[model samples]
Target chain A: MKNLLKHHETYVLLVIIIFSAIITVINPRFLTLENFFDVVKSYSFIGILAVGVTFVLISGGIDISFTAVATVAQYVMAVMIIRYGGNIFTAFLLAAAVGISLGLINATLIYFFNIPTIITTIATLNIYYGILIVISGGKWIYALPGWFRAFADIRLFTLCTDEGIKYGLSIITSIWILVVIIAWVILRYTKLGRGIYAMGGSMNAARRAGFNIFRTQMFVYSFTGLMAGLAGLVQALLVQTVAPNSIVGKELDVIAAVVLGGASLAGGVGTLFGTILGVTLIAIMSNGMTLMRVSSFWYNVFIGLIIILSVAFSAYQRRTKAKRAIAVEVE
Target chain B: MRSRHSELIILGCITTAIFALMWVFNPNQFLRIGNLQNMAFQLPELGLLSLAMMVTMLTGGINLSIIATANLSGIVTALILTAMINPDAPPPGSGGIIILAICAGLLTAMLIGLLNGILVAVIDVSPILATLGMMILVNGLTIVITKGYVISGLPNAVRFIGNGVVLGIPMGTIIFALCAGIMALILNLTVLGFNIYMVGSNPTASNFAGVNNTAVLIKTYIISGLYAGIAAMIMISRFNSAKAGYGESYLLVTILASVLGGTSAAGGFGKVSGLVMSLIILQIASSGFNLLGVSAFLTIAFWGFIIILVMVVNFISAKVLERKAA
Candidate 1:
């Protein structure tokens, strides 16, 4: 038990349980299985982005452009559906392709130019978002086809309770989980994954070790783009509309969640399980706030504070660990 | 420094070229007095925000919360102004109230800035994450306080700051110029300014040289926050209202302007004159776009493109300089 406590994930799990327990005590409605599923389903989109972003962060880069890329891809998907009578499969394929291309734009620019990743991505974010707005005439697409909206209605399991029937699982949630598992395996087993860690840890060392920096960066960004595209589709289907402006600025939330899950912004660290916990914590906080009838604005305030505190706590942990290691070496 | 001067010249050329092109396309309207005045008025808010961005960038950091800080300060001042004034009274003797409100608003901004400085300098959080948190926190606080409603019917003083003109020049522009001039003096002459550049250039080296790096960083962010406060004053008065989400789009443009003005993202390099020129170039481009019936949204894409273009130009110039040296 004490050994398990040494893991950051275990501590995160404990925090989640305690937080949920407190919220449940205050508002029992939050404890319902229905609400649990709702939280998981609602956060699934962010979860998918977080999964890909974990790779980028671990590889020692950041991509603020994913949200913009996702926005453009989703807009295209919507346009094709409503304007051109495109099928679901065609829309997904096209969106994924567009997303990959957009991701390549970011990867190639950063790789070739050797510019700072943050500035490069910020520039791309604006360009992609602005282009989408101009192309779409800044109009919201509302009339999505019925099939697309209802595309993910498959329930993994259903439970009948005294109150009502509730689905224990959803296809959307399953997709998120599947991605997480796949990403976990890739990070743990693949050479490219290990290469990413080496690159992020030290660029010169990684290059000296014969790790291809350009290819690794290209793969990292493209992977993020691909995930953003898939998440965008899920978001549109879930909401039944595509508001171009809505998705552009939420990259902060994803970054915050990834960082909160024990990922260092400085790179060379992060995990799939840690990211899941982070996403869940954020989702639960929002859900709890809504359930408590608190003003939504306060929600952002709390999130901001939580992000600062979480990052600070982790930094402190790393510092103490370093100090302990030094003390042992001295002895 | 040579590169900085060349960047400024390049920006000047770009601005003039755009102006000439616009004048040729529509000379009468583009050079009309009314349009010129309007452009002067439009330049300051973005100019001030960009200035604020440059200050932090000089320390090799960024304050993403500038827009949010501006909004929150404006909202605080608005709340004070509206709460103190009797609704039935028309612009009553409330000069003192206006002064008090402005102070409160500026104080609020400074406090927020101090929090950001502490987080980044003391707690050692990444500047991006720290400022991003502050942005969201303050934005949320502003929204909660205002209930997502716009606060209007500001005092006459706001009109003077926002829209008033003296000797045919806009008050906002005057304020921006004064602030920019003061900032230039500080950067060029003050010890703090020298420290900022040194720390930004190389923190470890500066520390070894006995420079107070943390103090410099804290001071830099505080100055940035104070600039945001000043900008809030201009913005609130100009719009005759305040809201939490107003100027939501200015954040990116401010960064764009700063970068275009020759502020390096990796830090230790920027110029006030360069930033001023960049602001003029963007403002003219935007005004020209409006005149040409181009979608205003497209300008954002242009701004993004311009950053990349400037970087490319800088890269080429650096390469040429290297070859010449070799």
Candidate 2:
């Protein structure tokens, strides 16, 4: 029981349950399947990005340029589809390719130039966004093809309520779930996944263990780039428009969700389960606040408090645990 | 010390080169007093912000909340100014009232900094996450107070600090110089400054040497907050208005300037003179681009390229030096 309670995911799950209970109590409507689908569908893109970022964070590197990569990827995909009449497969391919290349740019800069990950990403974030803005002239890509818009409406399962409203699990939400499952498999079973954890835990130790640092980093960043591209496509489909600057500043939200899910920014400790819970908690919190009729302005304040509190709680827990172990050894 | 000197000299040469190039490209427009003063007026806001970022980075941490703190401080001052003085009434505003407003604004920024310090230093939260949270919280508060509207119509006295000239120099530039000089002294001559570098470079060694890392970090962030507060005053005074989202773009530029000036991102090892030199270089390039009618977006792209180029140059030079030593 104690070991189970000590797990970070346990605490995250507990918070989700308690918070959901509170929200449901305040507004019973929040308990419905419809709202559940709504929240998950709407936040699926963030979920995808969070999952991708979890890999990088677990590899002990930070990437802030993912959002910029997403923006550029989605913009290019949208432009191509609108200009040349490509299908969904073409869209995904274009976004993924663009994302991979951009991600490689980040990796190369960090590897060859020996620049810090955060610094390289920050510089690249500006470069990518500036180039996009210069080329696109800050124009919004509208009038997307009907087929692309139709893809968003596909649902896996359908349910009908007595009130005659039909709701189903959205394709975007399924995509998020698929991404999560894939990431879990990669982290749990793959050698590359183990290498990522080892590297994040201690880079020198991992290097001594014969793990290819360069290949691991290349894979990590490029994977994130690929995810960002997909997320961008998901975003464009959901919104039905692509705005040049809409996606860049929200990098913090995704980072917060990942961190809140028990991913340490210091690197090497996080879980896919915790990340999903974190994303859910954030989505529900925002959604519930809207249901509760709270001022929208207070949203950031609450998120900030939650992030600080959770991280502080975990830090305190770790310190106490270390002290207890030390005392035990002395005894 | 030798490396620091060389870094500054190299930065100086680069700044001079950029300046000469701007003059050569647009000889008539680049050197006009009006344009010069305009650049002078603009340089201080970013300069002060870079200093704010540098102090914390010196301790191996970053204060992402600097822009938020500035905006919040500016809002508080604007709220006070607007509340205490009526625009249509006689005796526009008293000196005491203005001073009170300024103090209140600074106080707000300091309190936010204190929160950041406690979270980062005492609570052991990472600096990036802590400040990022503070940034969001403070921004939310700014929005709630301002309701997403601009607070305009400030008294002339307050505006003077941002727009007034002092003996051929803009008041903003003069103030920036004073602050930069004091900052240089703090980093060079004070025990706290020494401790900051020690803690940043290696916290374990510093702690074993009897330096209080927590206190130094807290003090460092508070000082960073104070700089942000000063920046707020200049920003509000110059714009004659305050808003929740002012100067959002300056956040990244401040980091760019710091790194270009030779501050390592991993912390420990930066010089105020180097930062100042880099800031001048950026301002000149920025202003020069404006004079040359280069697209603003392209200028941003240029800044990004310059940062990468600087880092690459530094890396290659370090490697060459290492080989020579071997």
Best by TM-score: 2
Residue A170 lDDT in candidate 2: 90
Clashes of 1: 0
Q: Cα RMSDs of all predictions?
A: 2.5, 2.2
Among these predictions, the greatest DockQ belongs to: 2
- Candidate 2 chain A worst ten-residue window by lDDT: A322-331
Using alpha carbons, what is the TM-score of model 1?
Answer: 0.95
lDDT values of the candidates? Answer: 0.86, 0.91
Q: List, residue by residue over B1-326, the lDDT tens digit for candidate 1.
A: 68778888888888889889889988779999899999999988889889889999988899999999999999999998888875447465688888899999998888888998998888887888889878878888888899889998886766799899999999999999999999999998999989899988999889999999999999889889999999999999988999988897888778888888888877898989999988988898889888888888788788788888877778778888989999
**Tens-place lDDT digits, model 2, residues A1-331:** 9998888888888888888898888899999999889988999899999988999999999999999999999999999999999899999999999999999999999988899888899889989998999899999988999999899899999998889999999988898888889889999999999999999998888999999999999999999999999999999988999999899888877998999899888898998889998898899889989988888888888888888788888888988887778542211
lDDT of 2 by residue, B91-182 (tens): 64377898999999999999988999998999888998899878888888899899899999898888999999989899999999999999
Taking all chains together, the TM-score of candidate 2 against the true structure is 0.97
Note the DockQ of each predicted structure.
0.64, 0.78
Off by over 4 Å in 2: A326-331, B90-93
Clashing pairs in 2: none
In candidate 1, the residue pairs with backbone N, CA or C atoms under 3 Å apart (3 or more residues apart, or in different chains) clash, namely none
Question: For model 2, how many clashes?
Answer: 0
